[model samples]
Target: MDSKYCPDCGHPSSIKRIDRKYIIHEIEHVLHFERGILYTIRELILNPGENIRKYLSENRSRLVKPIIFIIVTSLIYTILTHLFHIEDGYVKYHEVNDGTVSTVSKIVKWIQEHYGYANIMMGIFIALWLQLFFRKFNYNFYEVLIMLCFVMGMGMLIFSVFVILQAIMHFNVMSFAGAFGIFYCVWAIGQFYFKSKVSSYIKGFFAYILGMVTFWIFPVIIGIVIDVVSK
Candidate 1:
């Protein structure tokens, strides 16, 4: 304990203090996850920005890795949706199909059927848009990706809860999750990037809306390009 060297790294204690702390914290978090995954989920819900910043800048051992978290959440949501037969407005419209469903409804159904792919495609589009719009924040694509994974994973979890509730209560609140997703992203981005609450909310709102718009358009543009190329 009195030696001037880090016990873990064998470096000079003064210079390696931060590194030593990081290593200790990382080990503790790994042990914590072995105790329960709920601890990480609770921290993510209550203190997302701080936790995300920690994972991005410090040791990532404390939190579930972003990609794995996203995949797990997505799979849970997919299961809940199928199990509960929770049909969103779009899904309901798609089922009618008595020459009443619009082309958009069909497309929405297609997207829903391919939910995993759509989720990831939309996530990448949203992350790219965030990076472009918030370039001043100096977040690289990878960092933005981590942020999106957390936000989207949380959103999918919320949606899964809503789906379960709908199955039990026989009432539709599916759209509530989508609305919550928009607000959640806005609040999360604001908290993560901006110091001023008012400015952050303003920018975050615009960014979320524009991000969704871009996400929606990406598939349309790709489809058009494919059509043109094939023709």
Candidate 2:
């Protein structure tokens, strides 16, 4: 696998490998604090409202609380991304001149420079739509929105961790795949916990739609807010 090093932090690559045993170990540790982490991940993946129901039902100690999880995960994920400078795709660079440039070439160049904003917009909408569909599984609209706040927050945490990894360790693996894999692991544990109660298709589809959408939504919202407030 391709790897990198962070010049600033000098934290070398410590990841040994990705494997079933390792994953199980991680889940086991999480189970100690919250058994519901497995089911939360599962409902987050398969049946959106189910997790919320369990969470609200006083099975409180069974999993990592969503709020805390979101805060920690977002920080780690963003830091990793920042450190490694991972790119979903390349951004076009354009030169800027003082004030205004009134030419076709200049306009195109400006657009290229600013094009990342557009990609972010599309990503947010798609993620919201996926969450919306998943919410239809059992949740009403408000609940779905609430769940999305936490879910998307987790995605931000994941990305923030990526930024940290990039800055501190010069680590940048494919992040979306990493997100999907982690999401899958969470779902698997939930399935095991729930046994025959939840449908596989529900789990699979939920992850597919929400995973990609969450990836885009959080950052875009933050970016928009910053832009609006700054103006």
Candidate 3:
């Protein structure tokens, strides 16, 4: 009759069954949902800097504890995409009805058409640039970069799963979610990274603005580079 509280809502668990497998599975599901909501809540509640400090100073698990959250969020994101069929006008080459483009060509064309690939890469760069802007805070440049890289890895993990879902359902939500999600997750990382760099609250806010702007502009700059490289 031992009982536990729900990880997500902090509600008391009313175990419906005493079977070990069922209990274990149920607990895992609760923790998963709890993690996603917690990540979203924390991001919404604190300005980037404070959130970072909170994770940094507290338990190690708090830092980048968004893995389970990311998976859950991504799955829900996939489901919604399937249901709504939101259109960003991105089509894989072979899927195009015109039949003029090879699959690789279509992928490249899709990247060019919807501004997806570069925009996605820009999201990562913005996180890196933000970290550099606040280089004097505490950690070395590499350390900040590593943290951002981890953020990107987490982002790609969720994004990959979403892409798989899109393939199966013939719906295209992955590009939009991946692009925007990378921006947010990286920004989340930057929020904490800047706090660690700058001790003063005021400076941290400035860094946040700079980071935001850098994120917005990064795609254009990288697009130019890609255009040049392709030439």
Q: Report the C-alpha lDDT of model 1 over 1-231, residue by residue, as the tens digit.
A: 498987888987676456887887776564455544576688778877888888889868777777767767777888888777665622233244566544455465677766556666677777776776778887898788788787777777877777887888887787687787677777777777763567766776776677667877665576556656766
Candidates ranked, most accurate by lDDT first? 1, 3, 2
Candidate 2 segments whose C-alpha is farther than 4 A from its true place: 1-52, 60-65, 84-138, 149-172, 175-231
Instruction: Summarize candidate 3's per-residue lDDT along 49-119 as a digit string, tens digits.
Output: 45445545554344344334433443444454455554332223233456443434434454444332333
Compute the lDDT for candidate 2: 0.47
| lDDT by residue (tens digit), candidate 2, 58-106 | 4756546555555444444434434465544122224366674334334
Q: Could you tell me which residue pairs clash in candidate 3?
A: 137-197
For each candidate, give its TM-score against the true structure: 0.72, 0.38, 0.42
Q: Model 1 — which ten-residue stretch has the worst lDDT?
A: 87-96
Where does model 1 exceed 4 Å of error? 1-36, 89-110, 224-231
lDDT of 1 at 186: 74
For model 2 the TM-score comes to 0.38
Instruction: Give the C-alpha lDDT of model 1.
Output: 0.71
In candidate 3, where is summed lDDT lowest over 10 consecutive residues?
A: 86-95
